[model samples]
Target: MKRDPPPPPPQPFFFFWGPPTPRGRGGGGGGGEKKKNFFCFFFFFFFFFFFFIWKRRGPPPFFFFGARTRTPPSPPPAPAS
Candidate 1:
């Protein structure tokens, strides 16, 4: 007697853009994974970039805690004549 082949795996739910591709030795669905990785990298790059700017330059003037009036430095008194 002969046995039947196993059923294919269920489709993953996260992919909304298109139908699932057939899995094979060449690695199906690799393109979607690259897109996801790119998005993740982009988000983290901006996150760290803004965080670095904030650390180096402090908060923007519009922020409540950063809002402060500027004052000119006072002139030094003249030396005794």
Candidate 2:
């Protein structure tokens, strides 16, 4: 006897190729909200990042200890008699 054909694969939760439909309003609304939240997160992240850099008056410090230090210049040699 011939075996039965396999059942079709289940569909994915979201589809990109289909035309927009009124029935998909809920899903589309959720996507729009997610996009808005992503933008807000990045906006605040960059705002704080720049604020820290500006307060330090230079590039952000490394993960190690305090800000970098500079060595003082040597005193000029005394004039010969």
* Top-lDDT structure, candidate number: 1
The candidate that wins on TM-score is 1
Model 2 stretches astray by more than 4 angstroms: 1-30, 58-81
Clashes of 1: 0
Question: lDDT of all the models against the reference?
Answer: 0.60, 0.54
lDDT by residue (2-67, candidate 2, tens digit) is 975553333334333223333331233224345456668999999999889878886556634555
Model 2: lDDT of residue 7: 35
TM-score per candidate, chains pooled:
0.41, 0.36
- Cα misplacement distance, residue 76 of candidate 2 (Å): 27
How do the residues 37-69 of candidate 1 rate in per-residue lDDT, one tens digit apiece?
A: 777899999889878988999765765764564
User: What is the Cα-based lDDT of residue 52 in candidate 2?
Assistant: 94
Q: What TM-score would you give candidate 2 relative to the actual structure?
A: 0.36
Model 1, position 30, has a per-residue lDDT of 34
Backbone N/Cα/C clashes per model: 0, 0
How does candidate 1 fare on TM-score?
0.41
